[model samples]
Target: MSYVGWMIFGVVLLVIEILTPTFFFLWFSIAAFLSGILAMFGLNLGWQVSVFAVASTLLVIFTRPIAKKIMGEAPRKVYVEELKNGVATVVQDIDSSKGTGIVKISGENWRALSVDPKKVIKKGEEVVIERIEGTTVYVRPIETEAKKEGEEI
Candidate 1:
């Protein structure tokens, strides 16, 4: 192709790369621009293709890691532990032996269960929210510790 033709192709590809916002076409556009430069210098088809390939490969391989570092790592979603504790209301009777229940905390309902198997809690009883296991909240009877401090047992 003529020098002018190659330059026009390069410019079109570069514009397309900009519109698409992907780094992929940008490399090929750079290659095409280099090919156009080679054409302007009287290089033939075989030499132009070789230069474009080598330059594009080197640009991608050298720049990818640097680009990743500059962009930084993708932000991860916050875990459930980040939310406040001690504010959940029992939505279902938590049977420790049955191992199933639900609670509503911060306007979001969550599956819940007693962490201890021996404690049997009734419905409408306020409980302390404990650690999360998967999507379930593991709970214990509230004031149990305080009650224990006052009594012998």
Candidate 2:
């Protein structure tokens, strides 16, 4: 392909990188740009192709990790300890017997289970997280002030 063709291919790859952002295509795009430069200098087809391949491979091997590290880790998971005792709103009926529930806490939804398997926490009820086992949080219904006062009376 001509220099212009290689440059357009680079632009296409850049567009793909922007759209998906897997950090896989950016190096290829850069390699294509480099190849375009070589092509502009009257390099033959074999040299242009060779430069693209070598540049792409080297950039991916050497720079992808650095780029990913600079971008930082994916959103950090909320610590289990931090979530313990935190109040959450039940978003789905928590039926421990059926093994299904969802709760919203800290602006994220999470799978939840009742601390007591026989207990069913209904949707919209408030619950306190007792513990987390893997991705599931064990929880219990938060006692209302009325219930507490009645118990005291």
The whole-model lDDT of each prediction reads 0.78, 0.96
Question: What's the distance in Å from true for residue 107, model 1?
Answer: 22
**For candidate 1, lDDT tens digit of each residue in 1-153?**
877887887789889878973466677778888998999999999999898889889888888677668768856654687643675678888876787788877777878888787776676777777788788888877766777888865
For model 2, how many clashes?
A: 0
Candidate 1 shows a clash count of 0
- Candidate 2: C-alpha lDDT: 0.96
Could you tell me the lDDT of residue 125 within candidate 1? 71
lDDT of 2 at 61: 100
Which candidate ranks first by TM-score, i.e. highest? Answer: 2
Going through the candidates in the order shown, the clash numbers are 0, 0
Write the residue-wise lDDT of candidate 2 on 7-108 in tens digits: 999999999999994799999999999999999999999999999999999999999899999888878877879999999999999999999999999999
Which ten residues in a row are the worst by lDDT in model 1?
76-85
